[model samples]
Target: MRPPFPTPTAEDIRLVSAQLGRLARDVIGIPARCVCGAPTVVATAPRLADGTPFPTLYYLTHPAATAAISELEATQVMNEFSQVLAEDEAMQAAYLLAHETYIADRESILLVPELEGISAGGMPVRVKCLHALAGHSLSVGPGINPIGDLALARCSWTPTVCQCLVYDA
Candidate 1:
C-alpha cells in the first residue's frame, strides 16, 4: 500500500518553517512564532523530550487564533506523524491533484496567462496568495536567497503560495 501524504524530512520541516516565517514577516507583515514559542527560525531537527526525531512543522490553527494563544491551539497542531504518509508515490500524486483543485477553486487576478506558459503554472493564484499572506506582489519566486534550493525543490513551481498547502497538508 502507498503512503497517503508527502512526508517532509526533518530538513523539510525546518526549511518550510523558516520560509513560512519569512513569508509571514516580509509578505504577510505578521511575525510568526511556533506554538512552542520559538521565533520560527530553522534549527537542526528537534527531538521529542525522549530523543525521537520530530520532523515537520505543524500549525494547527490560522494565525488569528494562533495570536490569541488559546488552549485549543494544541488541537490544531497536526503531529508530523499524523500529517500524512509519503512512502507512496500516489500520495504525492494526490497532493498535486488536490493542489490543482485548490487552485481551480480559488479566485485570482491574472498578470500572466501561464507561469512558464507551459503548465497551468498557477501564477494567477500565486499573485493573490502572496498579496493576502505577505501583502506583496508575486515577484517573490524561488530565486530569493533565504529561499534556498531545498525550499524551492519542495514548492518550486508555486513558490510563493503552494508551500503551505503542499507541505503542511
Candidate 2:
C-alpha cells in the first residue's frame, strides 16, 4: 500500500516551487515522492486561491518524470493508447473507472461546479497526456490506472527509482 499523503512542509514547498519554476498555489499534499525524496505528484486543491477551477487533481512536479512523459507523448504513444482503448473493452471499462475515481477524489477535496466529471489526461475516452496519467498513477499507485501504468512502464523513467534529486550541500 502507498503511504499516507503528507502535508507539504516549507522545504517541500520550496522544492516544488523550484521544480515548477514558480511558486505553486493551492497544493494540499504530496501524494507521491521519489526514492530520493523529491515530490513526483502533488494533490492540489480543486479550486485555486484566486478562485480558478483547477481540474487536475494530481499534478506531476518532478522535472525528470515530466520530461520523460512528454517524450512519450511526442512519440505518438497516446495514439497507440487511444487505439488500445478502442480495441480493448475490459481496459476501456477500467480506464473509465479510473476517470470516475479521479473525479471523485478531486471532488472529495473541493467541489468545483465547472470542473465536475472532468479528469485529467483525457481519461475514460482518450489518452491525451501521459504526464497527467502518470501523475495520477504515481499518486494512487499501480493497478488503479492501467494506461498510466503502461505509460510509466514504457517510459525510460520509473517512480520506483529516483533519477533526479538534487540536495544542497
In order, what lDDT does every prediction score? Answer: 0.27, 0.86
- Encode model 1's per-residue lDDT on 1-169: one tens digit a residue: 0111233345444444554553221111112333443222222112334554432112222333223233222334222212332343543454345334323322121212222121122222121111121111111222221112122233223222322322241
- lDDT comparing candidate 2 with the true structure: 0.86
Taking every candidate in turn, the Cα RMSD to the unseen true structure, in Å, is 18.2, 2.1
| TM-score, one value per model | 0.21, 0.93
- Residue-level lDDT tens digits of model 2 in 14-114: 88888888887888899888988888888888898998999988999998899898888889988889999999999999999999989888887777999
RMSD of 1: 18.2
Give model 1's clash tally. 4
Which candidate comes out best when scored by TM-score? 2
Task: Name the regions of candidate 2 deviating beyond 4 angstroms.
Answer: 1-4, 167-169
